[model samples]
Target chain A: MFLHLFIVNKSGGLIHHRSLSSKAPKLGTNEWLRIGSTFHSLYAIANEASPVKLPGNKKNGADDGIEEIQADGMTLNCFQTRTGLKFVITAEPNTTAAVDLGQILREIYMLYTDCCLKDPFYELEMPIRCELFTQGVENLIQKYSRIR
Target chain B: MSRTPVNILDRPLGGRGSRAETQVSLSAFSYLYSELVQYHQNRVDSISELERRLESSGYDVGLKILELITYRNREYKREIRLMNILHFVSTQVWKAVFGKPADSLERSVENTDEFMIIDYEPLTSTFCSVPADFGQLSADGYMSGIVAGVLDGAGFSARVTAHSVALEEGEANNNNTNTSSSSGGAQSGNNGSLLPPRKEKAVFLVKFSPEVLERDAAMDR
Candidate 1:
């Protein structure tokens, strides 16, 4: 089951956070911000430490970064866009639908492009509080829950 | 440790991959645009205000897309000429947004500063239906903003407006007669008959600032 969702900007700031299940632990806004920055640093460190190198390049790696992490009976999956915006989702440890999570992340990205990026009222790198975005996310969560 | 600032031009086009051609579902876009319109409609008191909001939104998209498309075309240098920029907007930018080039690009015979970019079916207004009371509300204001953005980004300040010109059979004949008497008689005569039946057509009217024309003259000299 899905537990939480977090969107981190390239600057390691939390742009969006949503808790899917009521059973998920409640964290203060500051705590969530800390998690976002921590994860971003970890991602950078992982990319730096990886042994595999890109086919044509010596410095960059083909490892698309740390996509999934399992810890404390929970799993965290991250999907990063070409622009460096990251979407991280937390799910139960035994939840095996990695592909579905990726699809969800992509849909979220599309919503962000349209509702947030395209909006004149929305400032760049600001927390996404657009009503349309929230509605789209809720719809996606409902659809996924119904399928399960 | 000192780090050199990353130059955007020095980086690869798609960051990691060679050239990533990304696509969003049309239905998804339509829904989002509809919501955007509805949101603006509720807040604004006037039709022009609603259009202005839509235009500003499109402007932001246009500014980002100008950089992106220019970057994507690795051989593209900065466009300086008026005609070249218009061609870029009607062809490259239109294709990037709507998956096809504009139907036609025409220069106004009566006005030297005016140009028209025709789209047989503009994506932004395809699903939109203006109510009878809405009074000449063209959903293509967003597209106009995009055109304006492209022009402004290329150093040509311009005012772009969208007009729905889907004339009925009888009205087309009347328009043809009226145009035949005007300065652009031959061009209008051909345009009226060339369009297919029953399809919505939008014309983006672009009027460049006077300084742009002066610059063009100086460049020609």
Candidate 2:
């Protein structure tokens, strides 16, 4: 089961946050902001701090870092766009076996572009308050979470 | 106004852009371009201002195309480095927009932040007939904005500008073979071999911002 989802903009500002289940931690806006910025800087530092230059994937950059982190109960998967937007999701530790979190993140991205970007009132990199976007993401998550 | 009855979201966005890939005639393009130039011409007092207006118009187009291509091809979103993005721009972006790859891509020896992509017959400049009073303005200024928009959207945040310079001797030969038309014979008189090559070349100069260079330097360290 998915626990939480966060959409962080390129500058590490928390643009959207949703707790998928009761098991998810309830983070205040300020706390989520702090986490988003912290993760942003940490992601950069982690990319630079790698002890070895990874044998690069031609499809991916050599500087990519911290894709998935597994804990005792939960697994956090991050899918980063070239523009540095982050879609990080926390789910059950074994969910990777049953679910493709990366694909879900990609779908969320498509939803974002479709709903948020196409909205003329929506500005770039701002907090996404679009009802359509919120509903679309919720629908997407609900569909995947229902699968088992 | 015949329309596909399906909802917008249900229909695929252009479907790899193949089915809609019918060619736009040169006359239609030039007419549209002339109208654009005339529209902007009425608003601006100076040449640079006119170019800036055109550039900004292309900026949104670049962003839209970037998002569309990224959505169509998944591997593109994984690109994180500078050079890889540039390669993608020179190949994929160029082909998507112009129907062919650029003539050549090169880095400036004088500046680490600057790179150049040369196009022999840029779609923007080849048939564009700017008036004499427009001074040294090139229609490729709009093309530069598209490049800037794509780079900025990709997190590179580079400034791109286009310039037309003298084409080299060997470059003349390369251009003819690459293009389907063997119109090179008409480019010059009987003394084409002895004289220098034609000067119809457009170079797009991309200057990376300091912040982006810092990130790149940090990556290398």
Candidate 3:
């Protein structure tokens, strides 16, 4: 049921975006950039606005940001790591099965650490255009997302 | 590819070494460190420049080490807060590299963005005796560089510097006397200590960028 995946760097830059399904939103390149930066700021703001402040040090689950956005057709699930990397997936609300997206997101993160981080050519905060990383993500998203 | 000669790059950078605790002897390390310093001295014109070179070298190692350790860690433990990252550097990072954690982790009294990790008898400089020309230079610049690399890798951009905080013998004695009785000093003096009194100290100062401070503040408000 997963439709789209987005990777936002710590600086709020849209480093990677993939439409996992035909049902995913179609947008201009600039729009994705806007979405990444917008989500970045909003994540921080949401934390500040929250009545119960999450501890800053360790893993703060659901964090200070919006974890899910259940719209009419799309349900957006966000997983933000302690290092400020955010993984977002938009799924069909009816078919995504109320599953824990965080587990899959963590898996994707491990892929990132191994494929992109281990690559000497890869620089932090730069656009992730690594082939191995792309392949790794594809393998993960395919495995985790329910067959439509 | 199998026919090609195997070198450092070809070998597996596996996590097995950490488990095996493959430690290098202090004497061997001293020899390597002196050679590294001498190599940098020949390449750089100024002491600061030499230090920067050392820092950059350490930075390379720091980046990989931080990522490796975090990746190896099984728990969901990742540092988000400023204190958390600093604590990781002083304790976890230091312990991994130096076989011991830093002596103390302290926040700057005046500047909120600044923090310090004091390491008494830093591993890299244990046998290093700097030339008079490079007076007051701390050989632990590489150590500070590693700290900087780790912070930057973890999304906290910062500048880290290593300084020598070792006091003169007379002053050190006087200070020790003020804190403890003279009779107590004699016992400590001949207590068969491994390290001599008035040993040099390497203080690593980490000054984070303003943006980090702002972001952290915004998290609260």
Tell me the alpha-carbon RMSD of every candidate.
16.3, 25.4, 26.1
Weakest 10 consecutive residues, lDDT, candidate 3 chain A? A113-122
* Cα interface RMSD of each candidate: 12.5, 20.4, 18.6
Q: Report the lDDT tens digits of candidate 3 across residue range B40-112.
A: 8888888899899999999988998898777766545768788888888887887667656677899889988
- Could you say which candidate leads in DockQ? 1
* Poorly placed runs, candidate 1 (over 4 Å): A1-148, B1-21, B168-199
For model 3, residues A1-148, the per-residue Cα lDDT tens digits are 7788889998899999888878788987799999989988888788667787667533344476888788998888888877788998888888556556666677777667545554433567888776556766776666565443
lDDT of 2 by residue, B18-108 (tens): 5333334433454465567667878888989988888888888888879977876675545678898898888888877765787789999
Best first by TM-score, ranked: 2, 3, 1
> In candidate 3 chain B, where is summed lDDT lowest over 10 consecutive residues?
B179-188
Candidate 2, superposed: residue stretches over 4 Å from native = A1-148, B1-23, B177-198
1 or 2: which has the higher TM-score? Answer: 2
Clashes of each: 0, 0, 0
